[model samples]
Target: MSVWDGIVGQEPTVNLLKSVVASPGSGRDDIAQSWLICGPPGSGRSNLARAFAAALISPDQGLSDQPTRVTSQVLAGSHPDVTILSTNKVTIGIDQVRDLIVTSEQMPTTAPWRVIIIEDVDRMLERTTNVLLKEIEEPAPHTIWLLCAPSAQDVLPTIRSRTRVVNLAVPSNTAVADFLIRQEGVDRATALKAARLAQGHIGVARLYATDRQVLADRDELVIGLLGLRRSSDAIILAGRMVDDAKSQAARAVEGQVARAESEFRQVNGLGTDERIPPALRGAYHALGGKDEVRRRTTRLTRDVLDRYLNILASVYRDVCVLQNQADETAGLVNLENRPAITDLSVRLTRRAAIDRLETIATARRRLAGNGSPLLVFEALFCRLLVSDR
Candidate 1:
């Protein structure tokens, strides 16, 4: 299979990347050492980066004897020349950038190019992003940096101005549904439902199609929003959302935390019940501190809340779509919740629905600023309650 086979949709992006890979170092300065892959969430920016890395690393481009094997190794993250820095945490720290900068100065171990792929570059703090600016702007002859972000606006002007930008379009619902059927063996009906609900996000569509708990949680959130009546109800629902986000984050990281603790104990030669030696206490604390655990959990909780906000936004978006009687051919993201959407459309005007969407957007911005989700969501729901009435 070709290096780009796994990427669904994005034909233009695939062709452009393939051309660059096929004719690397032919004096085509447009394909620079640093590239920014910009797209919405779930547009497969990371996937595209990995595929390009595979093609660059392979001796024969896309015609290697084991092209599929090369691509698989890159995707599985076993390729030595291809370095991927991806994190589930809320921010990418400066320390991480320092380590990658060290690698960037080195020569390739095996492949012709040493490719560094940083997923979610938008999550890096301004200081952390500045650390890599010089390296990305003036990398070694064989070094290439691939940075992925949700949009161009998320990146700093200095960094963006020095890099080549590759924009990726979100896959249509029909495209996403077909991909699920071919890849995950999903039934057409379920695939279509998941695709529409996911709103062009392939990962979310797959989860919504396969995971019953996710489906149930989405239904509950939408229905709960529809049933909000009074300020008291909004306050109560806000608490529930905060609680749910916390629980979801905790569940996601419980396994990783357990494994980390186990590894730390093993490396430090301490048993579960053993007390730390007085001399080694500092090392132990540094390796497995409760503060670190709390920080990681907080980041995960914020990320979960971000996802919840996106889902919440989709509800109002669907309501607005129904109120306007938008294109008949295009389906709603929350098609399963059409009855509730119809009811909301009848009760609230299109302008009210638009205002509700804006409230959700404001809530997201507040949450990103380290504000409490409980308070932000409470205020948002109260505003939405007024709009609904």
Candidate 2:
């Protein structure tokens, strides 16, 4: 498959990347050594990186004499020729960078070049970035580094200056819907609805479209937030939310683990690999990757939960605005929840609603840090109730 096929709704980026790969020796050829791909969470940044890597390493076609070979590999784990470094523990420690440095200094094995991909590059701690800066500043001629992060500002200034950036924007809703229908085989109606609900996040759209449980869970969570009025109610809701987040995280990761194991078995014969000791080692590594992914998923779920809570907070803020006869658009959630919106507008003043919004924002920030979720919810509920007085 061609590289352009993998990246959806990024024609300009596709053309630029294609030109760079086609002309490896052109005067404007300084684009390949290091690239910082920046975008929102579901904006296809990683997909672009993978496609670019595939194109760079794919075999040359229709060349006469001995064609110039493209020697490269996509390394997610330990490889003699390539290294992909990410956080092995809770944090992206300096030790990981040290290992990356040692690996980068080594020679290529089966290819003319070695490549390194560091996902979640923004997670690199300051100390770790300090260690990585030297290597990034001066890399091996035959080596390439690709880093992916949410935004260029999240990365250190030094790192950003040393690398060319490829910015990928969130695809339009139509593009997202088309991709879901064409690539994912989702029905057009469902795809369109999910695309709208996801607000341009491809990953979120896929989850919303494919997973009924996810949609139900989010709906329940929002409903619970709206119904909560007392401190006890809030506490119970927080507990349920934590449990739901854990379960969803577990189920998602278990599926990934199963897929990885199945792939492992397919690649190496069942009994043959069973007899080889190194085969078990590879299996363990695969499992480890699954566990890491599960942990990340859990963290991500918690973040999503927090955002929902923020949305609920905004709804109350709107009610407060409506009560004070301020601009009606100031705080409405759906605008379509008109009856409830009108009722709330008549009940609370703008000052009261603004106070509630502040409380919600504070709770969200606190929830992101290390605090008891139940206790935080209790405080928030009490404050909101008191404000209603």
Candidate 3:
């Protein structure tokens, strides 16, 4: 099967990329030398980018090479010919932009075209983006840039002006389920369940389908949040969340780091049985970078866990609202925890429920500002306990 077939529910986008690859000179139609693929998280933006790259580097439909009009290469790395700039850390930094600039000036090694794919373009700090603006404005011949972001608004006005924008929408639930089941060997029932729970996020859907532990973790977090009673309880829960974040981060990084270190050793000319060579200094540098990435990822994961906690609190607030006989249309949908939600809703006033929601919102903002998760939860839980009392 062709690589394009893997991109489910993106028939229109697939057609567009195929047309560009099929064109006489790879669609050098305009001076606009870049394209933006924007969509929500897990909407397969990166998958589309990779597929397009594959098509550009090897556009040979039936193995007849006449320098096939469409030949694409896998520039999924920092290669001299085709560069892909992505964050090795949680946020893309200025140094990455500097590297891209240096790479952009180099001549292509083999192909007539040089392509750069920058995933999470929105993560670039303002100063870094400014550094990139000049190169983007006047790209070298045979150079093409592709940027992927969660939405158009995340990109700078200057960058947006110079690029052709492509919007990607979320696939339907049925489509997501079908893709998981057919491609990933997931059972139909499991795929469908994950598709529903993921809310159109393909990555999250896959995690749900394959990882029982992840599902259990989320469920436990939600259930624990519903059981909160006192301010002290909230404080303790927040501490547990922070610890859990660190533990999970370490667990996730262990295997990946080991594999990356082994690959680096191989690339640096070190034999499998030999100790790390002194000349392989650059490889060690890359390993250091990977560790930094792990640290940042840990923080981000912790923040995400805290955010889910807030969502749980919000659900409780909604239950409190329902208890006061508030408008049902405005109630939060906590179908899975319906009994608990119903009980809570019956016990609180609409005003009290709204107050709790306001508290949760404040906690969310505080978390964004790097506030102590423990402190925020303590305050929220105290208020909850008092209001209930």
**Which 10 residues in a row give candidate 2 its minimum summed lDDT?**
61-70
Better of 1 and 2 by lDDT: 1
Best by TM-score: 1
Clashing pairs in 2: none
| Cα RMSD to the true fold for all candidates | 4.5, 5.4, 4.9
Provide the lowest-lDDT 10-residue window in model 1. Answer: 22-31
Writing each residue's lDDT as its tens digit, candidate 1 over 48-67 gives 99988887777657545456
Give the TM-score ranking, best first.
1, 3, 2
What's the lDDT for residue 113 in model 1?
A: 80
Residue ranges of candidate 3 with Cα displaced over 4 Å: 6-8, 30-32, 61-80, 88-91, 262-297, 303-335, 342-365, 376-389
**Residue range 1-389, candidate 3, lDDT tens digits:** 46576676788888887777777766556334688889887788987776666566564631243324342335234334556776645568888788887877777786566777899999887888889888787887777888999999999998888788888888877899999988789899888877766667787778779878666666666666668776677677767766665665566566566777787777776776777666776767666586676675667565555546544665765576566556365544345776777766666667767777777777777775667766766666666653453
lDDT of 2 by residue, 1-389 (tens): 34455466788888888777767542224445878989887788877776666555545411213323332234133335556665534458777778887877877776555667788899888888989887787887777788999999989999999998988877877899998997789899888877765656788788889999887776676566556667777777777777776677777767877677666666666543465357477755756485677676767566566745644665775576566566543434334454655655555667767877888889887876757666776677667653244
Against the true structure, candidate 3 reaches a TM-score of 0.78
TM-score of each: 0.85, 0.77, 0.78
Q: What's the C-alpha lDDT at position 148 in model 2?
A: 90
Scored against the true structure, residue 11 in model 2 reaches a CA lDDT of: 83
